[model samples]
Target: MSPSAVKRKLSSSARSVSPPPLRRRTDAVQAQRAAQTESTNHSHKLNFYSWNVNGIGPLLQKQISFTPDATYPLRNFLKAHEWPHFLCLQEVKINRADTATQRRVELAANAGAQSDEPTYSTHFSLPRDKYNATGFSGKVHGTATLTRDDTLETAASVPDFDLEGRVLIHEFATIPLVVINGYWVNGTSNPYRNPDTGETQGTRHDHKLRFHKHMLDLCKSIEERRKSVLLLGDMNVAPTRIDGHPNLRTSPIQHVINRADFNLKFLDKDSETGLKGIDVFRHLHGEKKKYTYHGRGRPWGESCDRVDLIVASRKLVDDEAVVMDTDICDNPHDRGHSDHVPLWVSLDASTWLNQSESKVD
Candidate 1:
């Protein structure tokens, strides 16, 4: 009785002590690691917005200005549509009379008073004259950046082009993005006259060539520094005659009307080989009316042009970037905003950084 019973008990204890199968243990370990990785990547999704608010003067004057009453619609839009992570504002002007401290305090107060969340990093790219000269003398013709200010990484603004304050660059997180907010000088209608040069420089001839060269140089510089870049704001040049109605044809300059060649040659083309640059915009909104600026005096009382654009490097598009709906805002009519729409685009930080690292080889 003792030998048989003891042997049976010993056999049961031996079976219980045996370790689980190797494959099963490996599967459990993998599942735990997968969950950990997922948690680590739970970063906030980026949302960006850009607008040329004509001139901030009309909204708020004096040393300090507030526009919550005027920006009610904008604030409402933000709450309704989920406010963006960053806002790139063009035509943000500060009176030359105000001191830097005065300007900052006033703008900050205005922003806070207007919206639920105020921008943390304020990068004001004043015009070239002001860039070197002191005081806010000439109209500050550049860009403004407002960030959530919650992120660990700080924000910065880079001026891509300095000729008459046409470009401003901003970066958020490790995402090195270049924002060129420009207002090119051009004609009023078909081919309007140059207020200064009259013939030598209008919307068509050498004026465009010179301005475009500067923009191209900026793009090249951004490419050299940042792995991914976005060239945006009021380009003022139509890519196709179809960009605006044929009946509104005001300019005889064929090139301005036909933007395909121009875009393909400089923007889409590779510098060395003269091949096409990435058609990033087309990839997102094809054939859709992405027109940002419009005219009011047409026969039908309405005419449109696609001037403002958000063009990204091929790498960003291929890796799946985000572009919000490009809609024309109503503030232009009342708040002295420019006759253009506000647009947005979101980039996946993880995807971009990973791809850039891989390309370093």
Candidate 2:
């Protein structure tokens, strides 16, 4: 079946499942007591934040060159807010030589005077193997995840999908939840056609489709094992028209090259397990027109899109332990740092990580 047909089917099926009711916040006095008891209880909620840094080297340079009084956007933002327990970054773009230095700087900036060594452990994935064999320098381009809870350990990555440093999987100690961080392939255009065969040349769009298909298969495999999953990153595809400007449906840009491919890859349910993906942001703020990425050289409202996403299993959404609060960070300070804004969500770690009986959809 065509991708659009699959999308329609998924949409219709989704409507059949009623959404979970919202929970009420604790009263002020109750909140105070909860805060007092938070330290003793291991059931506190956790925060998860994800961002596409574009290129880490340039961002670091920008932060370092700032005048004493001038604010380092990311650093200041990290210091100003209460840090999340888990932080995932995409398009980090750093090589081996720069990893240590970059990590130290980031840790120090985020740590502030709180500690010399922050509690969070960091991991990075760089392009390797065939990628380097193609004369591609394994340099500044990758993904990284930092977690305050040491229980989350690195797991095996999807074989071919990790070529461009695009995927990272982490398994939690007690929870059946697996966090998948991805910087999906941005389908770029290649106008060159084969002269002899008169067939269109394969572009990055092909790779994007393949990557997404493999990712779906991987998620299905995880679900078969009865594990709950949370997939977050710069997916490079707006799952619905509500996700970006309506004009993007026809845009000639590389990222939006084959909209059908994206719809087919992400919108369809897993054929084997019947597992479907849910957009955490849209689920919370339906039809809200917010953009996380602004076009280069274009004014704010003139050209922008929401390519970053956080998708979770249906069971995770229903359990109320996976995604709590989600938003696109478009503060003035964060805007100047990168063209893409940060997307974050709050996770009820205690319930999600400890509740093994939680169903996996």
After superposition, which runs of candidate 2 have C-alpha atoms over 4 Å from their true positions? 1-43, 58-75, 96-99, 102-111, 115-118, 129-140, 149-160, 191-201, 249-258, 268-274, 319-321, 352-361
Candidate 2 lDDT by residue in tens digits, 1-361 = 2111111101222112112212332476334533443333344466778888876654444344434433334455454446566678887766544546555534433332222222344566665534321223555457776554222333434345466677877755445777888888777664323334546657656766667778878887887887877888988887666666645645565455455565555544553433476778888998888888876686576767788988888778875546778998864456555678888887765564334334422
Every model's TM-score? 0.63, 0.72
Q: Per-residue error at 6 for model 1, in Å?
A: 63
Q: Give the TM-score of candidate 1.
A: 0.63
CA lDDT, every model vs. true structure: 0.48, 0.60
Q: What would the per-residue lDDT of candidate 1 be over residues 217-291, giving only the tens digit for each residue?
A: 666666677545666666666665555654434456555444544475456645562223453455565765545
Off by over 4 Å in 1: 1-43, 61-81, 93-97, 100-118, 129-137, 151-161, 185-207, 246-250, 254-262, 269-281, 296-301, 319-337, 353-361
What is the model-wide C-alpha lDDT for candidate 2?
A: 0.60
Q: Highest TM-score: give the candidate number.
A: 2
Please report the TM-score between candidate 2 and the true structure: 0.72
**Per-candidate clash tally:** 9, 3
